[model samples]
Target: MNASRTPLFCDTVLAERIERAEARLMAECCEAAQRGDSPGFVHVLAGGVASFAEDGSPYNKVAGLGFHGVPSAADLDDVEKAFAAHGAVVQVELAHLADPAIGVLLTERGYRLESFENVLGLALDGEYEPVALPGFVIRRSGDDEFEQWLEVVADGAAHPDTQGLPWHEEFPREIYLRAQRHSAAAGEQHYVAVRDGAFVGGAGLRVSEGIAQFAGAATAPAHRRRGVQSALLAARLADARAAGCDVAVITTQPGSKSQQNAQRQGFDLLYTRAVLVKQP
Candidate 1:
């Protein structure tokens, strides 16, 4: 090991990119909820709770209830009943200023808060300085190497606790394949870090609406502590800057290791999202 080598961590500029990605992710989730898209339904699984309910898909389930301009406790009751029928867990997100009174009601009833994320951003054209890893190598993932990436992700997420909220096993596979196809169709970019010919870590960026949203970040457990993730993040930011994006963002749970990593990379906190859970 080189005595002068610096450990892997995020910087200020990279932090901004994650922040921007987070904002886009949150906005997308909210819109999905509003529109009752599959992605949106998954966010709130209140069964048939809303007066106006939209159904969900097999892969990413979602349903919309309640019309605008009218608030009803039945909407919450419907959601609770739905969760009971399915025994499913929903990821409920409410805007910071919207209303926590609802979330507070659920928390008082014994629902877990689970995890939360913070949104951060930075200009895409900004300069990015790489953290040092004397002997590590970074490169873009190859076309036929999807399984490798999946395996790396699976390996990283092997621990039950690391898996976060539970979903059917097939759900992640569906999301992963959809992401791959979306990336190819949209000409997205993915980067990976390799050590001694082993694929150890990865990161990706998708350009939409002239904004580059970063996603698909993972690192093999054994390869952590090396500069793999940091390098992948730096390279992704550099790629975003070159693509003419003005700013980048990322959303992460507050006080998570991911949040600490983003902060160490120099990302400032833009906003925090509060999640609500209602079990029937």
Candidate 2:
């Protein structure tokens, strides 16, 4: 894992690019939540934005703040109070480009580091090798099978390895469906892996500003190690490339199978962000 101080991770231009991408992604999520009436609200913060959902899901948190610089102590206080007002935990995703002092400041203010997530990126300038998985077909999901796709994704989310992660087990069926609907409404593409006419895995691709974000990827437990995810990934990448995306990015827990898979597919380690949380 590349730490924040690594030269490659600290490149000013790359950091700024990543910061903008993250901000755009978070803003999209906030918009999706609002559009779907998913019991959440988004608010602009000093250096970024804050999202809060009534369910206390950790997905509802401040992100993209302090990317250019550390926010003032007063601003942080205000953000915290806003989260508290919503009866939610005070969470923040601190990027490598963020002022290093923010970490110490958060810790001093009763926030604890929860996890490290690796942001991986792959350039789409080259031809991607086709993935052939016998007996399984991957394609863009249609509206008729939305529920099945959701079921497969939800089942995948329940895997032991994913338990306790924010937005993993916390999303109820309705909430998950709402999120997917929002993504579709926002022009994001959804893909599903099918075997013998049964949905086995799924993924989503969101293209914005020439960047394709590969997200919400999961494989049913029964289909693990069967190349379902790889096929899904290939399908999404091809679609994104066709859509004129020059870059593709995804976030995964450091050292997890997902991260390993991404690395194997030519994705370079960009930087790891720390998830910080403060209990109400």
Number of the top-ranking candidate, with TM-score as the measure: 2
State how far residue 186 of model 1 sits from its true place (Å).
8.1
RMSD (CA, Å), candidate 1 to true, equals 8.3
Q: After superposition, how far is residue 188 of candidate 2 from its true place, in Å?
A: 2.7
What candidate 1 gets wrong by more than 4 Å, as runs, is 1-87, 97-112, 129-132, 159-188
Model 1, 1-280: lDDT tens per residue?
1223333234543433343333344434334444533323323322112211122222222221111122345755665555555555544543343334555655666666654545655544447645556666777777787667756755554532242334223334444454344344445566777778888777767775556666667788767766666677777777777777765656555555555565566555655545545444
Model 2, 183-271: lDDT tens digits are 66666678898899998899988888888888879898988888787788888878888889877888887677787777667678887
- Please, what is the whole-model Cα lDDT of each candidate in the order they appear? 0.51, 0.73
**Quality of model 2 by C-alpha lDDT:** 0.73
* Candidate 2: stretches off by over 4 Å: 1-10, 36-39, 160-175
